[model samples]
Target: MDGRAARETPVHLRLTHRGRVVFGTIGTLLTAGVLALLAALGATSASASAEQSEQSFSTVVAAPGDSLWGIAESLDPEGDPRDLVAELVTLNGMDGSGVQAGESIAVPTRYADAPGVIPAQ
Candidate 1:
């Protein structure tokens, strides 16, 4: 027989105290690293937040040919022009009745912001 064991390295089972200690330490380190990574991600998400934007609006008056429907279509297409009677009534110093020809009013501009908010002279 040669000086080598037959059933040696073929199915080598590391059953020694030192081997078990090394494997346990490796497993503990891996678990600790994964836990730390999860903790860091949680902390980052908790600290994250969103921002808010402030908005303002304005409009022009109606002319001889322009109707409330036309003004609403040009300014606030999402809203009904008839509904805008409230705003128009408030702005152009008009009654709940209606508007006249050659009369200008503030049309709500939802498509974008007022270029420069200012008062009429």
Candidate 2:
């Protein structure tokens, strides 16, 4: 063997211990960052679905003298009752503002136990 061949190291075997440690640490950090980002994305999607499920509708029984306007006012006091009544009409597939007593109807509600609200019979 020539002395020149003995003096020169192969390119594939050029990394030192410190270089290997640095590369390993960098790779670990990159993996951890990617995992954290994926977890955050997953959490956001989960919360979005949870929120969508939370804003669901509720069933209510129409009482005597309970018009769509009155039901809408009781269910969503903070909102425009006319709009809510219109939505109720469309949701129940009603031809007009007429609602019979003891009839089941769907109403938009944010809480399961809403005050002054009658449940579906």
Candidate 3:
């Protein structure tokens, strides 16, 4: 080939041993970082569910003409109904304070035993 043709030809790129080692290490680190992040996310969700499952619930069937205020009061006569009502809403994933007759709802075991009173931990 002429010198001019040789000059125009593309040179193939090559990596030295050190360059290969560096690239390999960088790839491995990125992979490990992604796996670790995923693992942490999984563990967080698992722990949250575990915490929720640890708390036991009691089923209370709604009687005719029953209201959330009434139920909260019945659960704890001496304690504020608002707190219990809020808890019940959260427990049942209710949109509002409405309760239908004969509908079963979950009540925390602790609240059923003693209305408005949480025993010392």
Candidate 4:
């Protein structure tokens, strides 16, 4: 029939149901891929920034009569001495909270030197 022929001609020119579904699926996959890439980049950038902000350390030898509390106070006067001492104990892998005279330990360089005091190399 003439009417049936006209309808069939337009249907053939346009996309079929299967074609539309395939195109939609492809578009969703592409969008998800782009989002995943962006998330990875963002995480990398955050990690880099964290690394940069991390404090650098220098080694210091304990003197006679030096205690962990005193050393922490001298190195980081503005910070809590208890916390600094804990960090020192952890950094040097000391079995206990005790430090021997003339023992070298790693100390965070941030605020380690007071005004007019030269930082150790």
Residue pairs in clash, model 2: none
Clashing pairs in 4: none
Backbone clashes in model 3, listed as residue pairs: 76-115
lDDT of 4 by residue, 1-121 (tens): 5687667744346789999999999999999999999999999999997785464556777888888898888877788999989988987778877888988877766655544223555
Taking the candidates one at a time, how many backbone clashes does each contain? 7, 0, 1, 0
- Location of the lowest summed lDDT over 10 successive residues in candidate 2: 111-120
**lDDT of candidates 1 onward, in order:** 0.60, 0.80, 0.83, 0.78
The digit string of per-residue lDDT tens for model 1 on 7-45 reads 567765666998899999999999999999999998776
Q: In what order do the candidates fall by lDDT, top score first?
A: 3, 2, 4, 1
User: Residue by residue across 66-113, what tens digits does model 2's lDDT show?
Assistant: 888888887778989889888888876789988899988777555346
lDDT of 3 by residue, 3-117 (tens): 8976786889999999999999999999999999999999999999889967666767788998989988888888999998999999888999999998877887776555433
> TM-scores for all candidates?
0.34, 0.46, 0.56, 0.46
Model 3 gets an lDDT of 0.83
In TM-score terms, candidate 4 sits at 0.46
